[model samples]
Target: MNYTDEEICTQYGDRPKDNRGAVSPPIYQTSLFTFDTFEAFTHAQLYERENYVYTRGVNPTTELLEEKLALLERGEKCKCFGSGMGAISSVFFSLLKSGDHVLFVNNIYGPTQQLLEHLQNFNIEHSFSNGDVESDIKPHTKLIYVESPGTMLMKVVDLRKISTIAKKHGIYTAIDNTWATPIFQKPITLGFDLSIHSLTKYIGGHSDVVGGAVVGTHELIDRIFTYGFQLNGSVLSPQDASLIIRGLRTLPLRMKQHQDNCLRVIQYLTTKEEVLKINHPSQWKGGAFSFIDDQMTGYSGLLSIELKEGGFKKVAAFINQLSIFKIGVSWGGYESLVNSPIKENNELELIEQGIGTGIIRFSIGLEGSDLVIADLEKGFQALHSIKS
Candidate 1:
């Protein structure tokens, strides 16, 4: 049954009356579950998902979190991992043979590119696309991976169109839906094969946990679970799983506030002369908004802005002057963050991805819009002084 994201967020992972009728699910923090007999052990081994045998293979706490995530993504199953990279690597290792090729759509996560580079030792090939799925596909192309409202640039891809092309080519489609979250966009509903999330972000919500998940068909997820997840030992701790559960309960509310604050910040940014360009789905032209409006329920608190004129020194000055927004990596927490694609004395990867030198990526937190805007104004003043 199709449930609203708000309803699913609150209702999907309710524990039964077996645990003294507790409202919150208890953490099953154990290495293994003991079986009463050999027959029972054999049954658990045969049907791993139905019964927990080992914490490495399955844990009740993690399983409950997985079930809730699967429902949120509108998928048949989901498997959580120790980190976002773990989830992504498991998918690639499970599905791709030595000679298989993957076509990555625009502006994918930086670590994903590194992962593909490492996969070259195993004879896997990958290429970046200009968003033309049909033209980019080669005979050996087995998968099409995309990140919509992509990292740094906030570029949006047409998922339905990409999924349709993948279907025609008999290839699987996967997406890093971390930006939109399941509350905003469900790629599976639009025909994508898999939807992955870095649960450390919005799903975990509090910036307290580090984890990832892949949501897809029972068969596909099971293959990843067996071949990649277990073998790699990228298991989510029961404590972390419990924290994510608490985060899920308030996800809908958090996302709403995020969207509202993002809109306000974007509006404020438009009036700043130092702001050369804004990269956001809401600001796109040429029918981009039509797809965004139709596919996504809301936008998250992430956007990129290019300074009017600056090099690395000016960029550093601007970042240093910000008081409320902390200078750090990995956003989607309760605190605002500011990061530059071009770090001091560092080689430019963002430039290769078409991001500019003075571009700053903002992950607006649950702060008041007025206060956040004021902080940015001071940052701009610092940039002005540096430019002088």
Candidate 2:
């Protein structure tokens, strides 16, 4: 049955027998489950998803999380993993062969680029495109991967256009939908083959847990489950799965607040003289918004800002002076976080991706808009104090 996002959260994982009539799902923490007889054991082995024989293969708690995530993303099934990269690597390893090629949209996650480079050792080939999906296709291309409101720069791509192109060549399409989440964007409904998420981020809704999920057809997910997930051994813990389930219950409310806070932050950012550019979908003009604008219901807390003038020293000063916003790596939690795209040795890579050294990415949190704005004001004050 088709359920709204809010309803899906409250009711999707509710099983009276599984939870012993408790409203919340209980964590199946045991490593292994016992069967009454040899025939029962054989049935368990044969129908792995239907019956849980081992925690690594499947656990009741983790399976509940998977079911909810699959429904949220409008996919047939979902497989949870220990981390975001775990789910992503499983997809690549399961679907692509030694001779296959992959075409990636520009400004993907750094680790993803590194993963593609590592795949070269096994004779896999990959190419990057700056939104030119049609022109980038190669004869050996088996997959097309994209991240809308892409990593660092927040560049929005036309997913439908990419999906159409992939379909012409009989290729699969996968997207990292962590930024938008299922509440705002439904990639599978828009013709994507798979939708992936870093459940540690917005889906987890807290800083405590780390996990990932891949949502797609039963056939594809089963293949990944049997071949890649089992072999990689990146199983999510039952405890963490339960936490994610708790997070799911509040996801819709949290996301709405995130959107509201972010829009307010962007409004304040526009008034700053030092703010040169804001990379967000809401700011996309003309034809750029024609496709994506309609599909996405709202934006998340993640956004990028390019300063008018700054180098590493000024950048360091700005980040150091901020009190409310923590200088951290990952975002999409309860607290606001800030980061610079440029690192000690990765300046060239940032430049190659069209991300400037002065650009700062902000992950707006649940903090009030006034407080977040004041914190940024102090950051900019520190930036201005430093000599260019």
Candidate 3:
């Protein structure tokens, strides 16, 4: 039977079978696998089979996760990496050469900016645009890299428009879909060449693993699997792979709770006197809300809140006073966490551009909305308390 996306998500997204019917995927944590002979190892490597000749190239545990990811993204193939940056860097290295031009959104995750820095040193040319349809894309642009509803800043770009433009120019299109996750948005369905993820976030769902993935057409993925992954030696560990697989099973349930709690917290913040701006996509129809409405079925656990009266001191105070939310760097775990986005990070361009100064990001967890809102209330109270 042809299943709806939701049905497929239930059946395949969280397959209920164990190796011995144990009800959970086993963690195959071996570094090497035995081959029948040298010829078998050669064939496995040459043919790109899942039979593990080496863990750095492929592992059975990681391969299963990749298969599930390919299904989720609706791509012909997928590959996993040690970290999100690894996945991103592999894609870039595989596609671009010296003097090739890539058009990119400036508002992506900080490490993507770092990747471009290395690319520039390697003699690749690039253009930075707003990633909106209105922006001008020059001829000879070999690729268009997009990050939708950029997490740290909460800016949404039109992926479909950019994808259409890239196709017209014969330019490949890639997106960082970490914030939206497959449950919320599927960039491949919108005609992107590749959809990448920092699976450490929502896919892992528990802040336990640092892994990344790339999904694309079979031809492109085959090339990446061989050249980008096999050569780079940054494959996901079998243990981390198993953790991510477990996390994926609970993603839909966790997401529903995350959204419910985040919406309540956002509502509370929006009505507060200390708030200057609230940057949740569900706030309207065409602005930020429009992007979420048009592109995503539901918002993830992430959101950014901007306060007018608070600088670093207020942000720090708020973070310190939180009872339920923890202070940490990454999000999309079972626990709620808050961090300063506009703080002084080593990323100088981001700091100078006012991207990381008066903003605080919240990764709402699977907590009770009323309790989470109460915790936020205490934070606001502390912020005002210090000022008073």
Candidate 4:
């Protein structure tokens, strides 16, 4: 039988076997596991993905987390890692050979792009999908990587169309599904081959832990484990896995408040003279093709805004005046965060990405909308002071 995301999050992994019938799963914090006999030990080592002989291959705590994640993404298997890049790198190394090409769609994570650029040294090639994704495909293109409702511009492309295109050319498809999480968009159901996520964001919920995961069929995930995962030597600690497990129980509730607070902030920004354009999936007014409602159940609190004025000095002054919203490099926590791509000397690059020189990204937190709005008022006042 099928279960709701909340049910799966809260009670899917109900173990009644041990630990005084503890309601919360305990961390099996040891680095190694033992068996009754040499025969059993040798047998378990052969199927390390399932049986735990060493923590490097599997731990009871981290394995439990992986089970829930695989079910959440509607995939047959999953592998947890130390960070989001770990999962991405695993997919790349496991699937692509030295001569293969990669096609990236929408605005990918900056570090992901950097990793691909570094792969150029090893003879791997990558191209960003500018206008037509299908047109950018080369004979050697083996993967189509994407980030929908992209973190920066918030532009979303049609996933089904992209998946169909990739399948036609026999290319594997993967999406950085961190922004939507499994609560909003499930890529496998939409016909993609793999779905990857950064658990450090919404999954960890409190910004306390860093983790990553990839969900797909057993065949594909096994390939990643054999070639990319074990060799890369990235492991999600049992303690961190336990923390993420705690975060999972309240994901639905936190997501609702996040979207609610973000909507209020968007509403307030619409009335401000200092605001030029607001970029969000839920707030799309049809200028660009953002068909989110049909694909995703909801949007995260993250969104970007273009200021009426331009340049880094102006935007920096506004960010500095904010009392509640901290200027942080990461998001997906209880406290709100603000960041921007408008650097002091990257105007040409910003223009090329279709970004204004005064764009700012906000990750609205669980704090009441009133407080967030009040903090934003302070930022606006700073801009006004600069004008005077």
Clash totals for all candidate models:
0, 0, 2, 0
Position 157, candidate 2: lDDT? 85
Instruction: At residue 152, give the lDDT of candidate 2.
Output: 86
Off by over 4 Å in 4: 285-290
Residues 85-139, candidate 4: write the lDDT tens digits: 9999999999988999999999889999999999999999999887598999999
Residue pairs clashing, model 2 = none
| Sort by TM-score, top down from the best | 2, 4, 1, 3
> How accurate locally, in lDDT, is each candidate?
0.89, 0.90, 0.80, 0.90
Off by over 4 Å in 1: 285-289, 346-350
The sequence of per-residue lDDT tens digits that candidate 3 reaches over residues 46-67 is 7655566778877777878897
The lDDT, on a scale of 0 to 1, for candidate 4 is 0.90
Error of 1 at 209 (Å): 0.3
RMSD of each: 1.4, 1.3, 2.7, 1.5
- Cα displacement (Å) at residue 102, model 1: 0.4
TM-score of 1: 0.97
Q: Residue pairs in steric clash, candidate 1? A: none
Model 3, CA-based lDDT? 0.80
Query: Which of candidates 2 and 3 is the stronger one according to TM-score?
Result: 2
